[model samples]
Structure formats: C-alpha cells, structure tokens
Target chain A: MQLRLETKQLNYSIDGFDILKGISINVEDKKMVGIIGPNGSGKTTLLKHIYRALPSEYKKVFIDGRDIENYTHKQSARKLTVVRQENSSDFDFTVEKMVLLGRAPYRRSFESYTKEDMQFADDALNAIGMEAYRYRSFNTLSGGEKQRVLIARSLAQQADIFVLDEPTNHLDVHYQWSIMALIRRLNTTVLGVYHNLNLAAQFCDELYVLCSGHVVASGTPKEVLTPKLMAEVFGVEADIMQLKNGRLQLVINEAMTAQ
Target chain B: MIKNRVATPNGYGDIDKSNISSVKKHRYIASFILLPFLYVLSVFLACAFGSSTVPIEKVILVLKQELFGIVSEIITPSDIYIVWNLRFPRALLALAAGGGLAVAGAAMQSVTKNVMADPYVLGISSGALAFVSIGFMIGGVMLNTKWFLPLMAFGGALFALLMVFAVGGFSNTSSPARLVLSGLAVSITLNAVGQYGIYNAKNISSSNAVVSWMMGSLGGSRWADVWIPILSSLLGTAFFLLNARSFDLMTLGDETAISLGVNTRHLKRLAFIVVAMMCGVSVASCGIIGLVGFMVPHIVRFITGTEHRRVFPLSFLVGGIFLVCMDILARIILAPNELPIGILTALCGGPYFVWLLRKNKGRG
Candidate 1:
C-alpha cells in the first residue's frame, strides 16, 4: 500500500514550551489509523500541524509523498480535509448550507456553488444518514447530529485523506459507535486522535500510542494494547481479553497513582 | 430500522421544501424589489413633507423635470428649489450615509465575529469626528477644499482601525472580548479629543456649527455633498456582495474558514480597510450618525436569514429607507426646530443595543 501521509520528526513548541517533540508517524492509503494518548500529549497539536492550521517545517510533513508546504490552502483542502471538535458558530446556517461550504475550496472568490456541488453535498448528507435534517438549523441539532453533519461536510470535500481531532469527544456511546462505523465506511486514509482505547482497538487497523509528545508504541491494536504499556504510558492497570470473534476488548482495572 | 424506512422523495423529510423555497423567493423579491420601491417612496415623502410641505405631485414633477429633462409648466421656481435643491440632495445624502454606515457595520461584525460591533461602537466614527473637528480648529485652505474633510476623516478612521487591531491583536488568538474592549478604549479617547477641540474653538459660529454637526443633522446637505457618500456606499456594498461567501465562512470561526481554503488574515485586513473607508466617508458627509449601522443590519438579518448575500443588499436599501423616514420625523417632530437625525436613531437603537447585550450575556 502507498503511504498517504507521513510526518517525520515533527517538533512544535509554544512560548518556549515543547508540545510535540520529534514525533513521526505514517498512514497508508485506504486505512484508518488511530493515535491514542492522554490529555496534553500533543494529539491536537499534531493534528493541527497535519491540517496546516499550525505551520509545519519544510519537508517535515508530506501528503501523497509530496511536501505539504508545496500545496496552497485550496490544493491542500482538496487533498485532505478535517473534522474538528469546535464546529459551533455564533450565527446559524441550514444544514444544507453548512454542508455546501465544503465545496468552497473548489469555488472561485465570486463564484456561487453549482448544481453539481449541491448534488455532491446532498450525496454526502445521504451517506451520513442526515439527509432528513437537511433543512434544519445547524445549531438546533443535537451534539451527535452536529458531529455527523461535520463528518458529512468532510465527505463533501472529496478529499483523499481526513484528519479528525477527537470527532467523537462529546458523543454518547451509541453515537460514538455509529460515527466510527460511518468513518470506517469511507474507505479513505484517516488519522484520528482517540481517547477511547477500546473504540480504537475495535475500529483502527493500526495504532500509534503517544505519551508526553513521543510515539511510545506502534502496531496493530492487539500488539499495542498490552497491559504493561497501558500501565506505563496511560498510568492505568488494564486487562486485555480476546473474544471469539478475534476482537480485542480492553478492560481498564485501575489508575496507577504517582510514586 | 434504518434499512426499512424509505427516504423522503425530496429528502427534506416532513419539511415542505416548496414552502421554504417560496418563502426564500419572497425574501429575495422583498430585498430586490419591494425594499427599493419603498426606498424611492420614502425619498419622495422626505422631499414632500418637510418644514414647508411641497406637494407630492410637485415633488415628482420636479424630480422628473430635473432628472429626465421633461419640463413642467405647473412647477414654480421656489417649488423647484425646495424640492430639487434642498430636499432632494438632503434625502439622497441621508440614503447614502445610512446605507454606507449599515454595510460597514455588517462587515465589522463579521470581521470581529461579534454581533455588537459597528463603526460607531468601534471608534471609527469618533476618530473621523475628531479629525474633522481638529480641521475646523485649523481654519484654513484645508477646511475649504472639497476632499479635505473626507480625506482627514478617512485617515483618522484608518488610524483608529489600526490602533484597535494593534491593541486587540489581529490573529485568531485574540479573544472577541479584547477586540471590543480595545474599541471602547479608542472610542472614549477619540471622543474626548473631539469634544475638547469643539470646546476650545476660536469662534462661536464655527463652534456652534461643529456642535450641531456633531449632534448629526441633514439640514446643510447639498448637491456637492451628495456624490461622495453615494459613490462610496454603492462601491462598498458591491465589494461586500462580491465577497459575501467569504464573509459567510468567516462567521464559522477563523480556523474552520482557513481549513476550508479561506485566507482569513488577508480577508480580514481587506474587510477592515473597506469598512474604515466607508465609515469615514459616511461620517464626513453627515457628522456622526450613530446606531443606524448597528440597527439596520440586525433588522435585515431578522427579515432575511444571516447569509451576507441576502444581508448586504437588503441592509443598503433598508438602511436608506430607515434614515429617510427618520429624517422626515426629525424635520416634522418639532416643525422647523428640527431634531438631529442621530437623536432619533439613538432613541431607537439604544434600547435595542441594551437588549442585545442582555441576550448575549447569557450566551457568554
């Protein structure tokens, strides 16, 4: 499989405090890769760099094997899209209009969205099972519904890769599974930050465990979700069980206290 | 359950798509057709019902004769002068100033991402007023030139905008609260300077003139005063309409806009410059018309949705109608002892502003 995204020795700091120190990761085409980390482990910071929200160094990050710096914002948007946690707005837009904005990178400064663009948006909404709420106000939607709408917007972008920053953060368990399932159905390269290890294990084809700005472990979920690594990196005691279906279930026992 | 259910044919479920589209079509008609017709009617009314009431027929005849070269035998010279020279230009100035200020306000709100932002609240008008007052104090060829006052006003407005951005920081990192606070500080300081300039004027007549102008009136408007405001308002509205989609994206927050291929910083800088230019010209034309900017956009948004493509043009026409109607009230309320147009706008807008603040307080 071809590498869809690669970040080599990505380092970021703010106000002289190092947030992401020399972190490297690779995601293959048409695979969902998960980054599991504790809070303040630079998950969001790394995602920011990947999405070009924070400027990354030349040759540090590449999409489709080309340096990310070579692409303009519009070109990069066509190649990769993002679904962020902070999707609320001060003003209201209809779900249709909000999803239509995904076509913005394809539009010129003065050009209106074409009929084809609307068709793409509609198809994307249909994919997320949100076509029924097309006319509803975005702010009026529930948390899970809004997240689904946001994911639908990313789908409308028709990008080859998606970078999601905790897209399921505030959703309920049902919504979390549903959203993860929806993403899994996309069949595009996805790099996501996940707090729930079990969900990561259930959905992700590969995993990178980050601790204090470093990739502490990288492998399939069965290889990375060991009890020793969970206790050492996440400061938690856990039991890993294999079900008859060959899925790994992570049962967190207790949090280890600081010595 | 998900597999068994069939999707609605239109895919909008229970929502009546036709009804929604018809409503949208009506809004477009109201914005494009009805509002403009009302604006024209208000201009005629403004021309007809002043301290000396010229008949509406005569008002129409005067406009026709002057504008289209169709000479009228029924019109007298004094009637022509009253309608054509005095009321027509004054009404036109009111329209231009009102529309310009309102559009500027809408752009300001979008750039700052705050509903409460306007040219008046952001100190742009105060800065222009201060510059004009200082020019009045100088009392030279600068004051006599056609473009001098407006030029000074533009410079002052640009300076104040830069100051606000400097203090508040232009990056998304700066909170909206910081922007509003910086605007308040700049407004207060510039207002004091304007007041001091007027208070220590070398002569009484100029001081009184500045004082009345500061209170905001359309009494002295003439053909010479008409073109700048109209041109600026029209051009500014056109520019904003062309970039309406970007403004829509701006309301979604900066980071999201950036991810969607908008160069938010560049867009913001351009928006601020246009806003400053528009506010400066409006303030220079009709000395400190407050709150028309703040109120008109919100009213337009209420009638239309929050989309700028709908909001910008409607704001221009509605703002024009609003001020023309207000000027009529200002002229007739005391019957020759005219109240300043600004006082009426303040009377209406001050309470609305308070209500908005209280409403937004809960959100914050």
Candidate 2:
C-alpha cells in the first residue's frame, strides 16, 4: 500500500503568537523527507500539526487523500506514529512494559495483551537489539538507549507513516546511524525534522528547507543543501557534494563572517 | 546480571506445546495459590498482632463466631465484645481505610504522573476536618453524635476537592503540578479555618476532640459507623479495578494515553472524581489517617514492578491489613487511653516517604 501526506497552507498560533505561518509541503509515497531548520524555526510546530498534536487553521492536512482531522485519534494513530525528542517520565517503568504500551492503540479497554501482541513486542525489541535490556527500568537507560527504545515503541505501533521530531538529538554516533539505518530499512514514508544537515543530506531522498516559519527551499537533498541556502537560513557557509552512490553529502565550511 | 541474561528465553523455534502448557500452568499456579495464599496470611497476621492483651486464640475464636456464627464456649462475653464489637470493626475500618487510601494514592500518582502523590495531596482530609470542626461549633456535645461528624466531614471534603479543582483550572488548562500546588494551598487554608474554629470555641470537649480527630483514630468505631466507609471504599476500589488498563497508560502521561485510544481528557476527569470521592469518604470516617495511601502504593510498586494490574488491587488489600494492625497498636500502646491511629501512621509514613524520595531522587 502507498501513502502520501499533504499539508495545504497550514497556519497555527499559540497565545496570539504565530508559530506556523501559511506553510505547505507534500511527502511522496515511500520517500524519506527531511525538514531542516534552525531551532525555533517552526519545524516542530509544523510536524505537530501532522500528528494532530496542534490544531491547524488555514487549510487541511491530508493523509492518503483524506483529511486527517476527519479520522478519530485512534484511527490516526493506527496510520501514523511519532517519535518525539526524548523527555523522561517522573514515574519509572520497565523497558519491556513501556514497549508493550505501544500496542495500546490496537487493543480495547480492559483487554489484556494476547500472544500476538507479545510476539509483536518481542519482534520489535529484537529489531532494536534491546532484547537483553527488556526487564531493565526505562529510567536507568542511557540517552541513546532510551531513543532507540522509543523508536522500537514506534515500530510496535506498526504505523505506515512516521513523523519524528529531532529523533537523534541525544544519541551517540553509532546509535544515531543505527536508528537512521533502521528507519531507512522500514521502506515506509518518513517525515523527520533534523538539525544535522550532514545526516539528513546523506539519508533523505528529498528535503524541505525551512526558515523563520516558511519553506525556503524544497527539492533533492543536493539541491536543498547548497551554500546559498545554508548562508541565508542557518547563517553558515556549507559545501555540498555528491558521493559515488549519487547521494548528497554536506560539510560545514565555516561560520558566516560577522557583518 | 549474567544469570538474568541467561534466564531470558531465546527463541520460540524450539518451543513445543508442553513448554507453552508448562508456562501457562506456572502462571495459573502463581495467580491461584501463591498470591492469594500470601495475601490471606498477611491479612491474618495483620489482624492478630496488635499491641493489645488479647491472645491470638481469643481473637480467632471471636472472628470465627462473627464470620460463620460458630461460637466457642471458651471465650468470655467481654472478650467477645472486645474482639467482635470493638476491635474487629475498628480493625476492619482500618483495613478498608488503608486499602482505600493506598489505591487512591496509586490512582493519584498515575493521573498526575507524580511519584510523591497521595490521596491527601488533594486536601480532601483537611477540608473534611474543617467541616467536622464546624459541626462541633454548632452542637457542642452533638458533634460527638455519629451522623453529624461524618456527614459534615464528607461535605467538607467534597467542598475542598471542588475548591482545589477550581484553583488549578482557573487560568490555563489544569496540569498536575498546578493541581497539586493548589490542593496544598487550599488544604493549609482550610486547616487554618478549622483550627480557628476550635480556638474560638476553646471548649475542652470540642477542641480536645478535634485535636484527637486530627491525630486520626479508628477506635470506638461501631457497626453503625462502619457501613458508609465500607460501602464507599468497596465501590471506589471496584471503580479503580475496572480502570486498571487506563491507569497503566496514564502513568506515561496524557500524550501517550491519547495515542493509546484512551480519551485522556475524559479519563482524567473521571479519575479525579473517583479519587476525590474516595478520599473524602475515607477522611470523613477515619479523621485524617495519614501515610497508608502514600506508602502502601509505593511499597507495592517496588514489589510488583509498577504494573497497575498487580500493584493496584494488591495495594488495597495490603493497605487494609496494615491499617487494621496499626489501629490495634493505637488502642493498646498506652492501654485503656488510646493514641490516635493517625499519629502512628504519620510517624511511619513520614520517614518512609523521605527514604523513598531520597533513594529515587537522582535516578529519575
């Protein structure tokens, strides 16, 4: 099955301050689309609308040609999953137990987990290489390990589209790549927000460059990660290159000269 | 750690029907025999081991007669009255109160996502005390009448809960920290009002009775005073049991609950009402028994590993048993003249809460 996500001129405001202003973008089927922006550029606010975390006013956000808001929260959860930036819980929970909670959207109230649900959870744990840490308290895990577990939880949700907000923020290099590699292998449509231009350029099939709550550029990674766009939005001079596999690579040349 | 790793089962490929059957059998055995057996034993020990002069044999005999109408000729009438009428109902009240408080604590912790949360954190008890004190101002000796104290106390608790909700929800949407802070502020204020009423009256009877009530007592409880708390605790505990899955999801916070097909807004409102009502009833009858609700849930979590299905129900049972025993201590510690059960609970609960907080402070 193919899934396409379209955001049509979305606008959002909080406490009379505009967070997302008339922004629009389309995510094609089976493509890894990266949203690159500096902090507070409204990338997260835009992503939140796609997951129905915030209400959008200007137009519609459609998933597979249907209005996302028309679907109930459960129906939307069944189709799309999210991996937000890590925020620890005040209450402690076991890793296995936390992962199993991902199956919640599929079950009914008062229904216990079935064999199939356990199997699905086990498979997810195995996929993330966190099987041995199943019984460990989730709070005891390192930042990188917690991020991987969160991804595993998303996998257990078994959704078609993934909207991740800075998923690699706290991870080590090895875990960062491993998580990206897993996401790539899923072969599903992924829309992710990232601050790491190199990682996004290397992994994303298409890229949306956001600046001050607007889509400044949208195209192939090589086209979007140019020195000009970098200087304009991020206030840095960056070199963009193509590798042997025709994939884009970005290297920050220098910080922009003052004045 | 090595043993733990090795203990984890690898693959289902080698599994057969027999292994699966054995696992199921072990589960059944655990649920049917081990847990319940342990629970019953805990309850009996809790019931029998008070600081009083009564022997276990006499207590058991009285209990038997009460439960099944099987009279033992050896036990005397005063002992029977002490065991069956006075101590038994009081113990049962402590049990119900303890269990109710613990479950309420667990529920409050879950909904608010606060590890230190308890039933009294909402200020229901303090509010109830304020109303009970009001009863004293009007009736002098009449406040000692059974119905007036509990009725006014419950009314006060309900009023406090409503006030807390209003304060928390006044400006922005209600958040846990805001709710808890508001509840604390309201509790302190209501308590001041109650104390002022007592100070103004300054009558020996009303003031001393209020002070004793604040200390928390389950002594002097008769069957007449038993039914309301019993029914309220039963209904409240049952309500929590039914929402076990929701409580589990809620501890993860609202965003997770919403994604899990729970209408968190609705679930939160429902939980608030249930917890408030339970705490209100408990405080009204027991006169501000402290610590059971806070300590028992945390202790249960340490043992059961924070799965609400096990933690919630087991907490109620364990809390009930603990309170009964504590009540027994309160009665017999000074003999004839009683200590308030609340004093012992606060003494126990206060330190335990500090220890838990210190232990987990940096870990989270």
Candidate 3:
C-alpha cells in the first residue's frame, strides 16, 4: 500500500478556541477512507485543511510525500479534486458547461476548452448517466440531479484524488447510496466526511471517529464501531449488527442522558 | 455499474448534443457579428436625429466625406459640423459611457457576487462626482486644463474603491452583503461631500453646471473628451473577456473557485482596479450616469446568458445602442432643452430594480 495523503499532527484554532487539535490521518492509494463525528467535531474543518481551502502549516500535510504547500493552486488542482455539497451558484450554466469548468486547472487564461477537453466532459456526464441532461440548466435540476452533475465535474478533472465534504448532505436516501456508490467506483484515493455511520461503515475500508477535535478511535469499521466506543464518543446507545449480506449495520437506539 | 435509474426521461431526451453545439455557435455569431452591426446602425441614426434633424442620407455623406474625402455638392458646412462635430462626438461619448458602465457593472457584480452592484451603487461614481464638484469650487482655471478633471475623477474613484475594499475586507472571507453595505455607506458619505462642495460654490452658474453634470449629460462631449471613455471601455472589456472563465468559476463561491485553481484574491484585486478605471473614465466623460451600469448587464444576461465571454461584448454593443436611443429621446423630448440622460436611466431602471429585488427575495 502507498500513502497518497497524510496529515501530520494538524492543529488549527480560531480566536483562542481549538477546532482541530493535533489531528492526524492517512489515506492510501485507491482506498475510500471515511471520517465520522458528531456535529462540531471538526470533520469538515479537517477536510478543509486537506483540500487547502483553509491554509495548513507548511509541514503538516503531504500528497505523495511532497508537501502540499509546494504546489501552486493550479498544480494542486491537477493532482486532487473536490466535490462539495455547496456547489450551488446564483448564476446558471448548462450542465455541459458546468462540467467543462472542471478543465479550468488545465487551461490558460483566454484559452478555450479543446475538443479533447469537451470529450472528457462528455464522458464524465455519460459515466454519471447524465448525458441526457447535458443541455439542461444546472440550477434548474433537482438536488439529486445536481449532485450527479457535480460528481461528473469532479470526474472531468481527471485527478487521482477526490476530497468530498458532506457530498450527500440534503440528499434523499436513494441519492445518498447512489452517490456513495458512484464515488466508490472511481477506484481512487478518496477522503470523505460522512454523517451516516452505516454508510461510512459499509463503504469505507477504514473509519476514523472524531470527538471534540480528537481522533478518539480509528480502525476497520468492525473494530472502531463497538457499542462502548459509540456510547463514550457519540453519547448514544447503539447496537452493532452483522447482516447476512456481510455488511455492518449500526442501530442507534437512544441518546445517552447527561449525568 | 450503478444503474441509471435516478431521473425520469423528459423532453430533454430529444435534444441531442450536436444541437447544443450548433446553438452555441449561433450565439457566438449573434453576439460578435450582429450586435456590432446593430451598434454601427444606431450610431449612424443617432448622428441623423437631434435638435436639428439631419437626413440619414446627409449623415452618410458626411461620414463618407470625412473618411474618404469624397466631397458632396449637396452637403452644407452646417450639416458637416452637426454630423461630424456635435452629434457624432456626443453619440460616441454616449456609446463609450454606456458600454463602459455596463462592463464595469458586470465585472463588479461577478466579483462581489451581488446582482445589485454597479459603479453608481458602489460609490465609484459618487467619488468621481465629488472630485469634480471640488474642482468646480476651485474655479474655472483648473477645469480648463485638458487632463485635470478626468485625472481628479479617477483619483477619487480609486480612493473610494480602496475604501470599500478596506471596509468590506478584500479577502475571500468577505460576504457579498458586507461588500454591498460598505459600498452604500461610502457612496452616501461621498455624495454628501459632493453636495456640500456644490453648496459652497463661488457662483450660481458654476453650481448649476455641477448640478447638471451630476445629473449626467453628454452635452459637453467633444472629440478630445471621447477618447478616454472609448479606450478605457475597450481595455476593460478586453481584460474581462480574457478572464471570463475565472469569472464563471468565481460565481460558484470562494472555496469552490479556489478549489478549481482560480487565484481568487489576485483576480478580485485586478478586477476591482479595472472596474474603477472604467467607471472613473465614464463618469469623467459624462458625470454620474446612474443605472446604465445596473440595467444593461441584466438585459444582456437575459439575452445571452451569463457567460462573460458572450455577456461582455454583447453588453458593450447593446449598452451603446440603448444609451444612444435614450440620448435621442432626451434630445427630442424637450426639443431644444436637453433632459439629463441619468434621470431617464433612473426612471427606467428603478422599477426593474424593484422587480429584481422581489424576485431575489426568496433566494436571499
């Protein structure tokens, strides 16, 4: 296994309040790694540092053993792509044009997208089963359809790594599964922040459970999702079950009462 | 493979990909070729109609004579003077001011990510008007200098933009609401300063001149005054066209733009400077022409969509034609006395702006 992305003791604070305290995580090549935590546990904050949206210390993050700070924004974009839930815009563009914007990192100022670039966009839309909607206005699409189009955009980037921040937020159950499945099929290094523990358990090869800006436990889903850890970290009473299909399922029964 | 069972097939099924390409090509043709032709026709018609109407045939003869030195036996010196000197330069100034304001508005809206942003609303125009008012208070000698007024106006506009950026925070952290609010604050303060300067003017005539200029008129446009607005509008439009892709990405929000490889900070700073220059020159050419900036970009966007490549050039031409038509109406509406172009634009734009606010209320 090769390490594709690693964050070493990442620390971030705002106005004397710590958001991420010496957080560390590793994502290997072609693996889907999930981060799960309660709200305000800093899952999104950690992802921000990984994606360079929030600046990180020079030596804190690395991609393929090279410091992320060494790459210009364009260079880093060619190496990694991000798909976020907040992809909505006030303006509208055709679905095809929206996907074509993924080629921005590869293009120079005033340079039009080439035929080859257009093909990449088309192929991405097809892969996401959205070829029929290519001419549709992006903002006019439903939530699920818009998420699919955004995924296709990430595909068009042709990067080796994908960082998704709550990509299935506000999506229906069907869309959540379908979007997660689509991402799983990419066979790339994926770092995802997921709210649904079951989905994270089923799709992620490994899971990191965050509580109060600390990685309290991390291992295979079976190892990390024990009832005791759930009660302690999530303040919930949960029963872990093994389904006949060889999938792990968590049934969260009730919130733990405060002492 | 995940089954493609998500969305039900709709009318869009019949629209093939090739059809989209053809439609885009048509848009390109309409934007680049047809719009330019329409602009030329509008300029010609504007030359023909004014307080003293010249026939279209005579306007063409003057143009032909001036460009090709083809002397016409039917042409009079007054016809030559009206078509070439008076109406022609005024029309050109109107064209340049309109196009510049529209382009500046588009850029400002994109960079700020607010639909209501324009040079006038953002205090750039107020800054120029304020500086010009102060120049008036300094008496006629300073106003007589060729470059003094525009230079002062540019300085004031730039100062106001910087102040807005400072108050709004030029970084990605600044919200669109913050930027607009700061712009309004700066605009109101500068407008008050301009009013105070006018109130203290030495003569009533100089004060009246300032008032009329503030209301915006192309009545003072000369050939020498035409070049600054023309050159600035062209340069600003060119700079924006080249960065259209970046502008498109910017509309997606700051984090997304950065993730897509756009240097948002650098682009925003450069765009603000360009917009300031464009707005300053337009204001200097013809006072504070309100609402052309806010109105024209919206109209162009409705026609051509939000792609800046199409929107910028089309807005340039369409704005030029729209203002030329407005100026013609201004001339004929009062016959010999001219109505301020700014008043007309405000009358037209105010209602549309209200409608837009209602439309956007849900989104906000």
Query: What DockQ results do all the predictions give, each relative to the true complex?
Result: 0.43, 0.27, 0.42
Every candidate's TM-score, chain A alone:
0.97, 0.94, 0.98
The DockQ value obtained for model 1 is 0.43
Candidate 1 runs further than 4 Å off: B1-22, B135-140, B166-179, B201-205
Which one wins on DockQ?
1
The residue-by-residue lDDT of candidate 3 on B146-189, one tens digit each, is 67777778777888888888786345566556766788899999
Please report, in order, the local distance difference test score of every candidate based on alpha carbons: 0.84, 0.75, 0.84
What's the CA RMSD of model 2 in angstroms?
Answer: 5.4
Rank by TM-score (best first)? 3, 1, 2
Residue-level lDDT tens digits of model 2 in A1-259: 4558989888777798877777888888889999999888899888877886566453479888889868777788888888865566666676676788788778765578887778878889889888866766677677878888888888888887888878886778887787898889988899999887878887898899887788889998877777888898898888878889887777787998868
A1-259, model 1: which lDDT tens digit per residue? 8999999999989899888989999999989999998899988889888888787899999999999989888898899988887555557777778898899889975687898898899899989888767666677678988998988888888887988888898889999999999888888899999998889999999999888889999999999999999988899999999999999999988999999
lDDT of 1 by residue, B1-364 (tens): 1122233334335545423423554677767877878999999999999889999999999999999999999999999999999999999999998888888888887777777788887888899888877776775766777788888788778888987877863456666566667888998989898888778767546555567688888888999988988998999999999988888888877778778887777788888878878888888888888888899988887677677888898889889899999999999999978888889998998999889878777554
> Candidate 3 has which clashing residue pairs, if any?
none
lDDT of 2 at A126: 88
Q: For model 2, what is the C-alpha lDDT against the true structure?
A: 0.75
Better of 2 and 3 by TM-score: 3
Query: Where is model 3 more than 4 Å wrong at Cα?
Result: B1-8, B11-28, B134-148, B162-182, B201-205
For candidate 2, write residues B5-80 as lDDT tens digits: 3233354223232133233334544544565565565445545655556677777888888899998999888777
